[model samples]
Target: MGILKILIIVTNINTYAIGNLETGLWLSELTHLYHEAKEKGYEITIASPNGGNVPIDPESLKRFTLDEVSKQYWNDMSFRALLENSKSLNEVESESFDLVYLAGGHGTMYDFPDNETMQSIIRNQYEAGSMIGAICHGVGGLLNVKLSNGDYLIKDKKITGFNWFEESLAKRKKEVPFNLEAGLIERGSDYRKAFIPMTSNVVVDRNLITGQNPFSSKEMAKVIMRELGKLK
Candidate 1:
């Protein structure tokens, strides 16, 4: 196929209620996939629920979270500009991309689940046979999408996300508005996760792909590339 296009969705919320912690898109979750896709000549677009000036989780910029790719992305002026002026989700069309990726951060718990524009894009893209992938808490976006049949898109689909234990490990379990794992299960998703918390686990079920945490970002990108016929 011609140059494949990917749309990446990031959260707009800038803070978590607990500890007034700063939160936004996990930098590695976007940069790892972005750099890999760019190197392969894929076109990528960044968008947000309300658009413009996407937030980077302050914690993600810390030394602990800064991998080589993320460190490079931090200093890349052009990439920073692209993120600073992301397009609004309303401007996205399902027909415009070959894949859609939801980048994760704790802030996603507050915004991804209830945005109508995001829900529309996910539903439309899935119906159009485009691949959909999300990592960590970003999977929250898929929880609310309904297919044309009025059924939950994730129903009976084997998927994985930031597990409950991870939240507890991060010490935000009680602070988050709802339990992501519980919510996914309640919605009929056959949610599966890594036996060991924080492991890089990725699950592919048909058109949908999910990764358990930031550690899974690179591997998830490779899977997306394979699914798009970019790799063996």
Candidate 2:
């Protein structure tokens, strides 16, 4: 097959709903997937719901929390420039990709769901046989997606995302607009979780891959690579 064309969508929300807490795209979530895909020479296109400067959650930049891969992208001015101007979902409607990745940040809780464009792209992409992946709150983008027959995309798919407890552990209970864990279960999704809290957990259900949190980025990227036939 030709090189896989990847579409990565990030959030444009820069604040929390309750306290206006600073939040945006989580740096590592994007970087891990980016570097892993870059290594295999897969083409990546970054976009957001609004198509402008993507906000970086302030907390994700804490020097103590960044991994080697995340740090590498942080120091590269060229990589940083990508977030400065992302394409809007409007521009991506006509495009088809081999993989559609949604990068998570707390800000995603503010905008990923109930988006007509987002739901349409996901439905179109998944139906077209593209690999669908999302990490942490990015999974929110998939929450409201319904297929043509009116079935939820994740209804019977085993999936995982930033759990409610993880949000509590992150001390963001009030900041989040909804309990993601409960929402998934409510939608008939077979949601799973990590054995431990604040750890990496990635669940694969056929074409869909969902990660538990920012910590799940590395493993999620590996899964994406494998799913794309880049790994054994």
Candidate 3:
């Protein structure tokens, strides 16, 4: 089989209004997946709503939170360039990739939902049978996607994202606009998560896959790879 082509979508929103918090793509969420995909010989492309210099969530770059892989990615100039020069969503074709990944951060809460171009790309990719994956708030991107059958993309699908408890635990309950868990439930998705918070939790339903938090990043990539028959 030819190398799998993957498109990674990141958030452009950099600051949260509450506490004026700094937010962007979680570095580990993107790096863990990118490292795994690269090792598996997959072609990876980074893109965003407006593209250009995708932000790394400030909190995620903290020394304590930085895992070895993420730290390596932070120092890798070549990899950094990919994030810096991500293609604009409008400029990429869905058919070119075999998989789509939504990297998470609080910032995604602001830009992932209700973007016509992002929705179109997702809709097209879904119809084309490409695998779709998202972690944390990145799953917000899937909320508004409606199929030609006039049903929400996640309707009746088993999915999970940043749960309500985690939001409150993170002390952003009032900061974020809406509850992601509630939104998924309202859209008819069978949302599931880890019994314990901040652990690796991933749910795969047909062509769609979702993770609960940044901790689920590597596991999410493994699931994607397994689905692609590239992992044992």
Give the TM-scores of the predictions, in the order they appear: 0.96, 0.97, 0.96
How far does residue 101 in candidate 2 sit from its true spot (Å)?
0.5
The sequence of per-residue lDDT tens digits that candidate 2 reaches over residues 1-232 is 7788899999999988676579999999999999988999988999999998999998999977788888888899988889998999999988999999999998888789988999999999999988899999999899899999999999989999999888888998877889999999999999999999889999998889999999999999998999888422
Which consecutive 10 residues in model 1 have the weakest lDDT in total?
223-232
- Which of the numbered candidates is closest to the native, going by highest lDDT? 2
Candidate 1 Cα lDDT to native: 0.89
- Local distance difference test values of all predictions, in order: 0.89, 0.91, 0.89
Measured on C-alpha atoms, candidate 3 has an lDDT of 0.89
lDDT of 3 by residue, 1-232 (tens): 5778899999988888677778899999899889988998888889999989898888898998899999998999998888889999988854567889999999999999988898888888888888889999999999999987889999999999999999988888988978999999999999998999989999999899999998998898788888977322
Which should have the higher lDDT, number 2 or number 3?
2
Model 1: lDDT of residue 98: 81
For candidate 1, list the clashing residue pairs, or say none. none
lDDT of 1 at 126: 85
